[model samples]
Target: METIQRTHVTDAPPLPSPWRDAHVAVVVPTYNEAGNIAELTRRIYDLEMPGIRLIVVDDDSPDGTGALADDLAGQVNESHPGRMVVLHREAKEGIGRAYVAGMKEALARGADFVVQMDGDLSHRPEYIPRMLGTIMAAQAGLVIGSRYVPGGSLSAQWGRHRRLLSRFAGIYVNAILKLPIRDVTGGFKMWRREVLEHIGLNTVRSDGYSFQVEMNHLCEHMGQSIVEIPIHFEERRADSSKISLAVQVESMLTPFALRFGRRRRG
Candidate 1:
């Protein structure tokens, strides 16, 4: 397996007692992220945020990411029992399916707040404390780490085409869905447990990256309060991206489906 090297973010000051006491479960869906998972897990635990649990859902990556995650979970659990949980699926399914499974597992495990982030380290662990604080302070059901918001930025490594594509995606989704969120396609987000329960994971239909857009639409459709905070979105720390042509096609079609297809329930 390829190992990823990353600069660790210095530990932030301890969180307030109330935020530290809440059960926060971070659900990360992985495919071929063996190069980055170990580093990612370390950074999350380094936060030293009490009551924080990481649930890694692996899609049986051929590169042995699932096994690496299992080993890491075992080692972490030896000291911090249940701090890390790994769910190994039998086949390589879509990211949406992996997230649904992980989110359900988190809810079953009694997480008060659930976080969805990438395992590739593009979604920094350092921003998590602020996200938790934002949800509490804003009284929002979902808080998104947005790149298009003021003070938000993308990695300089991103080429003009990629940057434009990413920006256009948000605009296209908003144009069709009329959602108020500035970053509709952003993957880094924190969702309150009650919101996930209300939005019924089983009712979610998108099987690809469009999952982000679909979930946002459902939250807004249900009249849930949503908030976006600025985040400097980084490129993946290692390994190639998994965004395939098929996934892109699915993304383009999902908005139309949500707008014109069957009505979704809250």
Candidate 2:
């Protein structure tokens, strides 16, 4: 694994990522997350962590997330050009495409590590350092923020139906795919740059939530170490949930096909 050492040199304007010289980029894929973009950007900027790059990819969200992202990028780049990038696609692509696009950007921008997570505040920014530690300590290719792990917990507000669905999905997918980790379907994860290259991300066909499962499977297949750390999973508080009935259907069906297809091939 290739690594870079970077230093944070200034405290004034010119927010250049002197530290971002390290292998790091945080990718936040958004679709109509206008309410959350400003605070998210602020939190990311205020965070003094080294080697962290913030890349926002928006799919032409009608709520103006793309414009907000551009504006935020402008504010940050006043001192640090290219520190932040906003990729705008014509329409809403699936989560898989958004992440794959972000991964490509991370690599092109010379990031050694890449992260995928929701923009809805469900994933706390404070957890980034901890996940980074897991990645480094375990020398794992991927570190997952898992809700099903021993120390993990889920919010109590979700209704029984939603809870049941997620539970069933996790159990079913893990069983079929025979994944070693507990949270095979979680989106909050950090991926080593090499794992993404080895996984052949181009081959992942899932367009919905199941994208996580396929990515995890690919990493495990490549003989990369994976760690699942306990995390508190919370439901999004703002903007409507994007997990529509169609998305749910795809989530269930996609895993079945991927798991079985791989079995046959193996």
Candidate 3:
């Protein structure tokens, strides 16, 4: 979990507009993110990215995040029809299941590209443009907003232990899976529609943050082109983290399962 020191970039030049009109879907999985969802929605729309859709998958949070998201989606659709969507699940499953549901919805809605990001605002909306541009420009099946790469950084608010744990998770997963990705555990990623269509989403088994690792492994296993871009990771704007001890345990054992278990298609 040793921190790799690198020069940070303050502003990234906006890539060209060749892919601006593509149907892009931002699939966010939320659990008690009410304090942050509205602002997140605003920032995403404010980008003015054409054909952009926000799909908020809520796990029936006690804070009524699902209702708030539905209200927000309704408000946005009045002026910009079909600009936002909210999927309310029955209970708190795991992030992996939430993402599977949201991704399926996005594809069914005709998303040309799919984005995975946290609803807590830790994954900035501004980076979406760069990620989209990268996927199109590089013809990559996936583009990752990476903190472990050069010019990428974590929140200064993160203490030593948290930082170490995050970094070690990626290193440990890579050591076992031997994937070429630098940020195997990162949640912020952009996927071409075809990649998701072929990744066998329904077959994925991990139900926690390890979902990120499994998806990366699947993409590599399927020989999909992948790219990484530097991003400054931020601390959540509000609400407590949803990560639990069970999630941690699942993440710890996921690599072994993928390596030796019969479910490597995940």
Best model per TM-score: 1
Error of 3 at 218 (Å): 0.0
117-202: candidate 2 lDDT, tens digit per residue:
88988876667767776787689999999998999988888799987878888899887878898877789999998888777667
Runs with alpha carbons beyond 4 Å of true place in candidate 1 = 1-13, 263-266
lDDT per residue, candidate 1, 1-266, as tens digits? 32324454674556798787789999999988988898888888777577999999999899899999988888888878998999999987799999999999999999999999999999998889989988988889999999999999999999999999988998899899999999899999999999999889998998899999999999999899999999999989778889899999999999999999985453
Look at candidate 2 and give me any clashing residue pairs: 14-79, 19-51, 20-51
Q: Rank candidates, lDDT, best first.
A: 1, 3, 2
Encode model 3's per-residue lDDT on 71-179: one tens digit a residue.
Answer: 8888889878988999989988899999999999999999999999998888988898889888997999999999989999999999999999888998899889999
Better of 2 and 3 by lDDT: 3
On the 0 to 100 scale, the lDDT of residue 227 in model 1 is: 95
What residue pairs clash in candidate 1, if any at all?
Answer: none
Q: Which of candidates 1 and 3 reaches a greater TM-score?
A: 1
Clashes of each: 0, 3, 0
Candidate no. 3 TM-score: 0.93
TM-score of each prediction: 0.94, 0.88, 0.93
Stretches of candidate 3 exceeding 4 Å from the true structure: 1-18, 264-266
